[model samples]
Target: MSFYDVLARGDDALDESPRRSRTWNFFSHITCNTVVGLSKIVLNTLYNVEVKGLENLDQAMVAARKENRGILTLMNHMSTCDDPFIWACLPWRYFKDLDDIRWGMAASNVCFTSKVTSRFFSMGKILSCERFGRGPFQPALDACVRILSPDNTLDSEHIFHGLGPSTDLAASMAKNLKEERNPLSPEYKPPVLRKKTSLLHVFPEGFVCQLRPPFNNSMRFFRWGTARMILEPTVAPTIVPIFSDGFEKIKPEKVEESAFDFFTFYNRGGKVTVNIGKPLDSAIIDGFRDEWRKLCLKYTSLQDSNRMSDELKFGEEAKRLRSKVSGYLREQVSKLRLQNGFDKEDSRFSDVNWWVKYTDTKGKSDPSVKFVGLNWACRDYQSNVKIYDEKGNLLQERKDALCGPKAPRKSH
Candidate 1:
């Protein structure tokens, strides 16, 4: 299939509604683990993945298991490989049974753009959310909250089966494929813990950070939605900060909208480092809130002079709070990077006006034009890019085909 083919079928693919099924749930465990296992070899070989501060995650898991609480892991999103690489680098040897408890909030459009992709991610424990739609953040956030709740049960109604029969004709076929493939499979029930332990990993930035040099000020301030999720009153999982360095090298010479690029990137061989920071629980977040509120109000009032409606005021306050929390998390990550020698004070670029201020040693940026969306591009000229069909047919030719939206790899 062509990239445009997928893009053209957005309406047919996007589904924000809920779905559930007991049979599908059982098969998901089998499929999710299978995909993850295969992905490990590819990621480890290409990325030379290294993990640090594992004790932080180990402790968080311990806390979750003991108290029946959940964990909210906050990581900077540089590329799509961040999640799989994390899985690849984790000390799984010590924790053999802790596989299925992890969950992630993924972009609704990119991750669930098709029924097939949606089912794959859903089984893998990825919840979807719209980035710009109304209440865009609620569905995935709520799912995380519900899953993390200690009283959570693997009730039949709660288990996701697949798309309802009425919605997609292929949904049932996918379900049947699962059952036919595993007729003797045991009934699937999400592992139930006394406190229902789970891990909720999120990228507070909401979008991929620009692929800039390590330790640079490329990381965006965290959006308020992440903070809102962290501060949820019903349940507050311990907030763990994770920093991943070095997936930018995976981008192909011409970024393609194909799964092949994903595999190729990982198989190319590069070093990736993941560091876990200390958890910021309620007390820590509370200590920062008063200052956060002040910073937010000052900035919000300056940005908009007119008085805001109550709802708008709440949103404004929340936005500022998110920024403050993001900044705090950014510092923690920078510290970890610096300590590990992957970062240097002089090598950093300013977040503000990076293109203008941080030119290379010769006062020039890299000559290669970066793939589209917001990125620093050097002056260059190119032409005649090749496009291929799913069947390996040469589909078309175009100039500047690679010059758009350098989206990170889909976390799937």
Candidate 2:
């Protein structure tokens, strides 16, 4: 079937929303196919990018196709360009036609103030414009309903992404799909031997939180949303948690939609690689959050710990992450209720002194390796509260609790 046949039909009421039809979308198959073709040309020859899990994808797809099933490739969402690049580098030759590489994109109406923004992103199925739509925006949700329908033939792929920390891509998918009896749906009612037809791409970090040197490890607690996709028992696609290194080096603001998201000219230029791990048994995700977090941390540290200090590599992402991490610190402090004594809220939450949680990888149970988050206390205040690593050996002895909005230059 033609790729056009695979995309979701926007709205049936041509009389009402004439502009919403896939045909009327001036950027039609010719334009999109040409666009995907150009994507191949630029991605193949442009920069130093190495894909690790492509072979795994091929093997999975072969089995999936034979079984008439679908796939859910969960990954870390770092930069916008990263998704297109990942799709572009897939083992498309095995799929017969490269047009099958297309998937959905999730973005907010941040730029939809103008018609140009709508047209630029209108090529895809969903044209979301709900800022706080998380509550009760019907139209935004109705579009999602059609976009993620369980009918195997309607839409072949969906790219799931969340805007901020609160953005729950996995939750949104699980909840909505649950309405259709997703495998993880508590009230899921399974169909008898039905065929599967879509591929789900998800990044579990929630948002691209900024991270600075030393503590640059991704705080990926795969403890939530994603697990629901499989736990429901109604639908569970083979889950692959892809680990990508070298992408954080590229900034987002520099990524232009016109360039097909490659950002070749703007990027200072560096190698970006994605290591696709094995497809996970959906059931294991439920109890494996802690297990996976340790694994993610280990791999991240072993591969890119040195690079974490190389803030220059991440440019805008680093700046953004640093701001986020800094904010995260304040948020944690606020959660601790340290700031409630004050009247209103401090515009500069950083003004309140708080110690940074430094992961000291010194003498520990895991032996010389593995990092844990901790805040230093002065020698005097270090009394009954003894913080040790996995091994029960005191990593840092503090005399007093350090409280401040910012960590001292010497402390970090």
Candidate 3:
């Protein structure tokens, strides 16, 4: 039978039992495959997307598979569509198992703002996490630890909200951890945990940017959670670096507000370029973490932020290192971007007012851009594809320029 027919069969509780797992498994497999397929076409046709460093990704995947480990993709966030776009470009050769082994951490405020959105994202293996809260007590870190931990200890006990709870607070918190019910009200069944996945994607910047002025000079600094994930012993996920640009060119309606517009998605066109880098050697990342600690301890503020101990006090050094780590990772990403010919000048895109008004000037008062299928887009446009190694050195390149007029111009 068709995929949707099978999917409709499991419309009830997704986690009811092992039978449900198989049902949803079949569903997710079909759905993600469809998404990837459509993404390939839309990305190529509408955006003229290009990719490099497949060899680097392939090598890392090989090593990860050999060791039965996971790869943590560290990326620069430029737009709301960043996560799905990356997944679309990920090499299917490695993820052929289709076991939903990929995961991404999404901002809680954005992803879980409503039940509808929460359900849509949960299917994509996206974990909702709080962006701002007390330091040394991050819920995101706890979530990451659970997903990466092979033994699954973090899942059993919820991480306490704040630093230290008093006698009464401690008892209440302990009880909350032992239950499998909603945190706010005990009567509700806890949402089913997202399926087990290995590869975790994170945009450490904590916020999306359109490369506007002032912030245009450098990629925004990232949080320390990525570094923390790398240092964790549970998965010790290899750090894979990816650089992507051109999403801003679409200039979607209300993009500045960060709301996703499906019309703009279907009608957008621009060249997107991505470069994947080799997994940073674990030894190198570990060594950097060690050096970071020494610097933190030497400075009281840094030490407090490190949360190495409860008695430590916040000091200036911690603040400095926080900025330092952010800059270091941004620089690495910038290097990849530069290698692939992306610079600050090409960081943003805007739609002419006349163009925006022209798309739906007739019957549809509001624009309703239909997603032209991926195959149609690919068949319509010529694409240039390349593969590279860990060093940002090219290993292979291919270009297919079918005979056809270029993608329609989006603006006057």
Candidate of highest lDDT: 1
Please report the TM-score between candidate 3 and the true structure: 0.59
lDDT of 3 at 412: 25
TM-score of each: 0.61, 0.46, 0.59
List candidate 2 segments past 4 Å from native: 1-35, 91-99, 111-113, 125-196, 217-228, 231-234, 252-269, 282-412
Candidates, ranked, TM-score: 1, 3, 2
lDDT of each: 0.51, 0.37, 0.50
Collision count for each candidate, in order: 6, 26, 5
Candidate 1's C-alpha runs over 4 A off are 1-22, 93-100, 133-137, 152-195, 212-217, 251-259, 288-315, 344-412
**Per-residue lDDT over 1-412 for candidate 1, one digit per residue giving the tens place of the 0 to 100 score:** 0011111121122223222444554665566566667768777655577788889888877876676556778887776666655666664453244333467777655577678988788767777765432232344554554455434422211121122334332233334334232211355322322224667788776656554333342455455566544443224457788877766555423333545655566326677778888776567675554444344334323222222223322455555555566566666666765665664543333242343333222134533323333332221122233444422245554544543433444544
Q: Please write out the lDDT profile of model 3 over residues 88-115, one tens digit for every residue.
A: 7666664565543566677655466777
Q: Which stretches of candidate 3 lie over 4 Å from their true place?
A: 1-20, 99-101, 134-136, 152-197, 213-217, 251-260, 266-269, 289-326, 343-412
**Model 3 superposed RMSD (Cα):** 16.0
Ranking by lDDT: 1, 3, 2
Question: What lDDT would candidate 1 get against the real structure?
Answer: 0.51
lDDT by residue (190-305, candidate 2, tens digit) is 22112334454554433343334433323332212333233211123445556565555654422113334444433445676666665654344433333322332333222222
- Report the lDDT of model 3 for residue 243: 83
lDDT of 3 at 409: 30
